[model samples]
Target: MLGISFFSVVSFLLVWELACRNGVVDPIFLPAPSQVLERAVRMFTEGTLLWHALASTRRVMVGFLVATMAAIPLGILMGTSQRTRAAFDPILSFLRPLPSMSWIPLSLLWFGITETQKYSIVFMGTFAPALLYVIDATRSIDPLLIRAARNLGANRWQVMREVIMPGSLPQIISGFKVILGLSWTCVISAELVAAKEGLGFLIMNGKEFFQTDTVVLGMVMISLTVLLTDIVSRVIEKRILKWQA
Candidate 1:
């Protein structure tokens, strides 16, 4: 499977190279693979590529951590209590559909074009969906287990800690893995502001100057970074859910 996938990508790039060389595609619009490779080498030598990757990584981690921390507890509470769910449902409804871009103007106004604003964009965009994922995960727990726990004199907190949290963890981790990817997307919008570094800024800057190679490079970097994070998340999930192993 890996060989096939590798060959498929190589074949595609080979065709793309031929297309560009034969003038079927404009280099100005779609640079050849060699051109992109040269550009990558240039960026790596300049050390900007690592900087952009690290900057984006930092933003993603901070924003994702904050969102997960807030969402898990609140979502579990909402799933376990009807009254809590009712109270928060309207607010979640209002915030859920609002894209990260929509929060830019207000975030900049409130946080003043700082890294905080960038992080805020990621947080705002990811928080609602993440909350929903956690809520559904918690809600999906076997009711009989919960009832049994309560019958054994487990209080609300104990029930949540001993029964609910354990049952929902696997799903929560899986959902947050996706949410982490969403945070990467939100960081792009966040960097649209006064940011100087980050994959998003790299792409936008390339766009401003018509440097499609840089744009493509930024996109590729983002994809690769998200893939690496996903792998790391899976490892962490395995360790945390070792009992399920």
Candidate 2:
């Protein structure tokens, strides 16, 4: 599978490079793979590429971690308690439909163009969905299992620790992988406004200068970063869910 994927990507790049060299496509519009690579090399040598990538990565991780940490416990509570879920349902409904871009104005007003504003955008964007995912994961646990745990003389806390948590964890991790990707989009939206450095800023700056290669390089970097994070998530998932193996 890896070899096939590599061959497919190489073939696509070869075709793209040839199309640009043969004048089949305008370089100004869609840059060749080599052009994007050259731009990446230049930016890396100048120390800007890593800086922007790290900036965006930091914002994404900070916001994503904070949001998930808050969501998981609350979601579990809401999932276990009907009254809590009912109380929060209206708020979730309002929040779940809001796009990350919509939070930019309010976050800027609330946080005043600081890093906090960027993190807030990502937080607001991801929190609702992450909560929903966790809620569903928790509710998916079998009631029979809970009853059995209780029948075995387990207390509520023990039942939660040994039964609910393990039952819900796999789905929570899977959902969080998706939320992590969503957090990247939120960070991009946040950076599009007040950020001085990030992949989003790089893309916008490159666009203003008509530097298509730089723009493409920024986009490529975002994809690569997301891919790297997803791999990291998979590694963590494997270690934590070794029972699944």
| Candidate 2 stretches greater than 4 Å from native | none
C-alpha local distance difference test of each model: 0.92, 0.95
Clash totals, every prediction: 0, 0
Residues 1-245 of candidate 1: C-alpha lDDT, one tens digit per residue: 99999999999999999999999999889888888788889999999999999999999999999999999899999998999999999999999989999999898899996899988989999999999999999999999999999999999899989999999999999889889999998998788566999998999998899998888888889999999999998889999999986
lDDT of 2 by residue, 183-243 (tens): 9999998887788899999999899899999999999999999999999999999999999
Q: Would you estimate the TM-scores of all the predictions? A: 0.97, 0.97
Global fold similarity of model 1 (TM-score):
0.97
What is the model-wide C-alpha lDDT for candidate 1? 0.92
Per-residue lDDT, model 1, residue 76, is 91
Clashing pairs in 1: none
